[model samples]
Target: MMYRNPAILTRLALLVPLGLVTGAPAAAQEAVSVEIVPGAVSLAVGEEVTLTARVLDAEGNAVDAQVLFFPSFADGRSGSARQSIDVDRATGRIRAVKGGEFLISAIVATARNLRGEAMVSVAFPPVDRIDVTPLGGSTYVGVATRHRATLLDTAEDERDGEIRWSTSDGGVATVDRFGILTAHAPGSVVLRAEAEGISADVAYEIRENPAARLTDEILWRQKEQFSDGVGYSWIDSLKEMAEGEIGDGQLARAAARFPTNTPLTKEAYLYRSIFASHFPGEPAVRCAPEGPSIACSTPAAIAWDPAFAGMADPSGRAVQGVHAHSY
Candidate 1:
C-alpha cells in the first residue's frame, strides 16, 4: 500500500531560459569581508597616515560602499580622521587618526538590491608638538647676537604667540630688541626657552675672537702711537712703556712694539697698568717687570705719577735698563 512505484510515475524537468532549455543559471550569494592593507606603526601625534578599505562581491567584481576609519582605542584622548567619502569608492584611499588600533568600517546600502560592510584595524604612533629654532648662528665677541625662541603646537599656534627666553652667559651675551645676543669673548652659551615656566635649552658655541689678536705689522699699518699715559687711544705699540723702561731688555717686546721717547715710555707703562685695572679692554692684567726701572734711577726721570697706583715695583726703587746710561 506504500508508494510502491511513486518514483516511476513521477517525472522531473529542468527549468531554463527558453534558448538554453537543457541548463539553468546559479543564484547570487553574499561576499562581505574587511581587510586593512599595509601596517601602521608609530606616528607623530599630529602627523598623517594613509588608510584604505576594500569591498568585493562573491563573483570577484569590485563592490562600492561608504568607507571610514577611526582609532579603536583613543584612550579618552581627542583625535579625528578625515571624513568618509566615495573616494575610497573611486581610489580606495583615506587618512586615519593619531593613536591606538583603528577600527575601519565601511557601510553600503542599496534600495533592496545589496548591502556591504567592512572593518580594518591599525595602530597610530604618538607625536611631539613643540618646536624651537635660533637665528644668525654665528657671532663675534663684544658684539650683540640676536635670537628668536619659539614654542609651537605643531598642530596650531597660528597666532605666533609670545615665547620666553633666557641665557647661561647673559653677561658675555645679552638678548635685546628681538632676542638678539651681543657676544663678549670666545666662549659657549645657551638659550633656554620657556612657556608658562616649562623650558628647554639649545647650545650656542662662540668662537675665539679673531680681531682681538695683537700683531706688530697690523699695528704699524694703523700708524697707532702711544698717548704717553695721558689718554687711551689706538696705537702701534708702547709709546708709553718704551720710554719708561728705556733699553730694559726684559721689556724688549713692548719696547720694540712702541720704541718711544723717554717721558712717553715711562708714562706709557703707567698708562698700561691703569688701563688694565680700570677698563676691561686689554686682555692681559699687567706687563711691567718686578724690578726698578732705569727711568727711576736715571736723570730722565718720568713725571712719576702716583696716579698709576700699581705701575712700579713693590719696593718703590727706581733703576734703569741699558738706556739708563744716557741719563
Candidate 2:
C-alpha cells in the first residue's frame, strides 16, 4: 500500500502531466531535497563562478536528477531579464555582467520541487591600466619634482587603488613610494608606477647645474697654482685654453712642451723652445738658438731628459741646434 499525503497528491497531480514529476517505487519517491555546494560567492564584473547542486532522498542518500540553474535580482525579477547575470544551464556556471547582488538557484523538478540557492555579490571591476605623468623631461641635480599615477578602468573611468613607484637607477634618480622624484646625478633613469598588475614607465634625465661646473673649474685652478716654477701666466694660459680662448691644436702643442718629471724652473724654457722650433711655433720663452748642437733639441733629447721627460713624445720631430741648460 502507498501512504500518501493529500497535499503531496495534489502537487503530483498538478506536476505529473508536464513530465516534471517521475513515477517510481514508493521508497524512491520519498520527498527529496537539494544542497548547493559553496553556499555563497563574491565576484567582480565580467568574472565567473561555478555552482553545483546535489539532490538527496528523504532518507539522506544522494540521488541523480536533471538540474537547472537560474538567477534572480533582489527585487524578485529575473537576473537574465535585467541582463545582469549569465548562466550556463548545462554546466551551472554563473557570470556576472554588472555590479549587483543576485540569488542563484539550482532546481530539481519533481513532485516535491526540490531546490537550493546561493547568494552572489558582484563588485566593481578592477583597474586595467595605469597612467603616469611627466613622461619625459629633464631635471637638474639635487632638484625634486612631483609625479602622479592615475588608475583607469576598462571603461576608461578613473579609479582608486594603491600604487607603487620606483626608479631604474637610484644613483641617477630616485622616486619615493608616493611618486616624488629627486635627481641625484647626471644620467638617465626610467621611472615606473604599478597598480593592480598594470604598469607604466617614463624616461627621465638628470643634468649637472651650471653653478656646479663653475665650482669644479675653480677647484682645478687652485690646484694648478701650487706647482713649482709654474707662474701665474702659465696658469692663466691654461685657464684660457679651457675656456676655448686657444685653439685645440695650439693648446695641444703648448702642453707637449711642459716638463713632466722635472720641477718647473727657468731651465724648463729650453725644452719649450726646442719643441717650438720643431713644431714651428713660438715657445712661452725664447732661448738662444746658436750654441753647441745648434742649441735645438731632437725628439729623443726631450724623451731622454731625466729632468723633463717621463714618457716619449710620439711625434719624432728631429731638431739639430739645441742646448741643455742647468739653471
Candidate 3:
C-alpha cells in the first residue's frame, strides 16, 4: 500500500528492522521533534557537504540517538534518469553527482523514528575547454561520419553538460545535435561544438565521389585519350622522335637538372625539359603528379595488380586484363 506521506512510509519501513535489531520496545525511544543543522546548502558537482541531526524530547531536552540519511528528489519524483546525489547513511555526508535540487531526510534509528530534512542545490562545474575528434579532415560528398565533443573543467576533469553542434556553411555540410556530420556538396566548411560559453571548431573538406562517374557510357562519350583518339600513327611518331632526340647520357643526368621527379623515360625527359623552360622551380614541380602509378591509376591502386608496381607508364592500356578492346 502507498502512504500519502512518504515520511510515514519511511518510518514504517524502518520500524520492523530497527525493532528486531535493537530488541527495544516500540515505546522505549521517544522523540517529539528532530532538526537538521545547516538545513539548506548549495554546492558544485563533485563537492561535498556534511549535515548534523538533533532529536528533542517532550521536555525540550536533547536526546542521544543515531541518525541515518536518505535522499529524495526535492521535485517530488524519483527515477534513475534524474540527476542523483550520494548520501552516507551513518554519517550525513553528501557528494554531488550532477546539477539538481535534493531533499535529504535524516531519520533517528529507533522503533519510533523522528525525521528531519534539509535542501540541497547542486550546480555543474564551469567548462574550461571542448575537445573534438578528427579535428580537420576530408570526406566524400553524401558521406556521413560521427564526431565527438568532450567538455572538461579547469582541473582537466570531464564535466557533464549539453553540447551544441553547428556547421559554418549549411550548403556544404550539416551537423546534428549529437555531432553527426553529413556532407551535402563539394566544398569546405567548419564544424563547431559549443557548451557553457566555450566552443571549438574543425575544418572539413567535402569532395565529389569519383566512383559515381566511372560508367562505360560516360567514359566513351568523353573521348579523353589525347593521342590515341586522334590517330595511332601520331603517338608512334612522337615516341620515335623522343628516342632519337634524347641520349642515354642525357637521361642519366635528368636528376641533376630537375631534382624533383627525375624522368626515367626519354619521352618523360623531353616533356620535362620543355615544361621546365617555362616553369623551373620546386613549386612548379609540386603542381604536377609524381608518384609510382600505372594505367592512369593512383599510387595506391598499384596494389590491384603485381605488374602495376613495376610499370611507370600512366597509359590506360598498360593494365593487362582490365582494358577492353572496344575502348
Which structure is stronger by lDDT: 1 or 3?
A: 3
Candidate 2 global lDDT: 0.67
Ten contiguous residues minimizing lDDT sum, candidate 3? 318-327
Kindly give the stretch of ten consecutive residues in candidate 2 with the minimal lDDT sum. Answer: 318-327
Q: RMSD for each model, in Å, please?
A: 22.6, 24.4, 20.6
Residue pairs of candidate 2 with colliding backbone atoms: 294-321, 294-322, 295-321, 295-322, 295-323, 296-321, 296-322
Q: Estimate each model's TM-score.
A: 0.26, 0.32, 0.48
Best by lDDT: 3
lDDT of model 1, residue 14: 29
Once superposed on the true structure, which residue ranges of model 3 sit more than 4 Å away at CA?
Answer: 1-29, 45-48, 72-88, 95-99, 133-136, 146-150, 154-162, 176-178, 216-327
Best by TM-score: 3
Q: Residue by residue across 61-124, what tens digits does model 2's lDDT show?
A: 8787878887888567532523777888767898887666888888876533568888888786
Candidate 2, residue 230: the lDDT equals 57
Please give, for residues 222-316, the per-residue lDDT of candidate 1 as tens digits: 22122323323222244444455445553445654433321234445556545557654423332433233332333223335443333342112
Clashes of each: 24, 7, 0
lDDT of 1 at 98: 29
Q: Which regions of candidate 2 are displaced past 4 Å?
A: 1-122, 211-327
Assess the local accuracy of residue 143 in candidate 2 as a C-alpha lDDT between 0 and 100. 88
